[model samples]
Target: MSMQQFAGGNERFIRRYEYDDSWVIAADVGLDEDDIDVDIVGSTAIIVADTGERVTETEFELPSAGDASIDIHNGVLTITIQK
Candidate 1:
């Protein structure tokens, strides 16, 4: 697992973990589920969060197959891709 922060002071953190047949991504940002949007196409995943005057975006690569599920709980956005 690895965690990285983008080049901004938006407090956006992205963590990625890889399993045998799946990939998991956890984002730590101070936003609710209703303020976030997720889009996955091909092997790329895009996440966007709108919080007041701050709008943050993150893009990363995922596995080629399967579907992705996203949920936000306690300010943590969890994305899971299953194959």
Candidate 2:
């Protein structure tokens, strides 16, 4: 992982966890479920969130390419990447 505090021009807090088969990321961006987008390209995970007040784009390197599952709860964004 790049260990970036935040993605370019992003205004939020992010945390990352590693597992045997995947990486999980959690972001506190205060966004709704319908206002976020996630993708995995090669070894990178990209997250984009757009709300009326703020728009955020974040990315981090993963161990490898994997599938992603995303959900938002109480304004926290959680993403799990399965290798």
Candidate 3:
């Protein structure tokens, strides 16, 4: 593999897409559910992961004041927002 392939920490930890009336975010959060915390303050969603070695925090603004549904599967954290 090329050295460039390992850029962005091997892969992007976050993926975001917009729907007609909503937005979806899928993130690679390898930590256990107990180590992950999500919170919506105003129009921003915050994600914090404590992986023993480090603490990673991510935040994104929601499209308007939408509602969000969050879940985790196979170490993937998914958030769907409805407008």
Model 2 — which ten-residue stretch has the worst lDDT?
Answer: 1-10
- Sorted by lDDT (best first), the order is 1, 2, 3
lDDT of 2: 0.73
List RMSD in Å for every model shown: 3.2, 3.9, 6.3
> How many residue pairs clash in each candidate at the backbone level?
0, 0, 0
Local accuracy of candidate 2 as per-residue lDDT tens digits, 9-50? 445677777777777778787777788887777777788878
lDDT of 3 by residue, 1-83 (tens): 11111114647567777767777777777766788999888688898989888888877776566688888887877878786
Error of 2 at 3 (Å): 12
Candidate of highest lDDT: 1
Report the lDDT of model 1 for residue 53. 82
Candidate 3 stretches with Cα past 4 Å from truth are 1-10
| TM-score (C-alpha, index-matched) for candidate 1 | 0.70
- The per-residue C-alpha lDDT of model 1 at residue 50 equals 89
Instruction: For each candidate, give its TM-score against the true structure.
Output: 0.70, 0.64, 0.70
What value does the lDDT take at residue 76 in candidate 3? 78
**Which window of 10 residues has the lowest lDDT sum in candidate 3?**
1-10
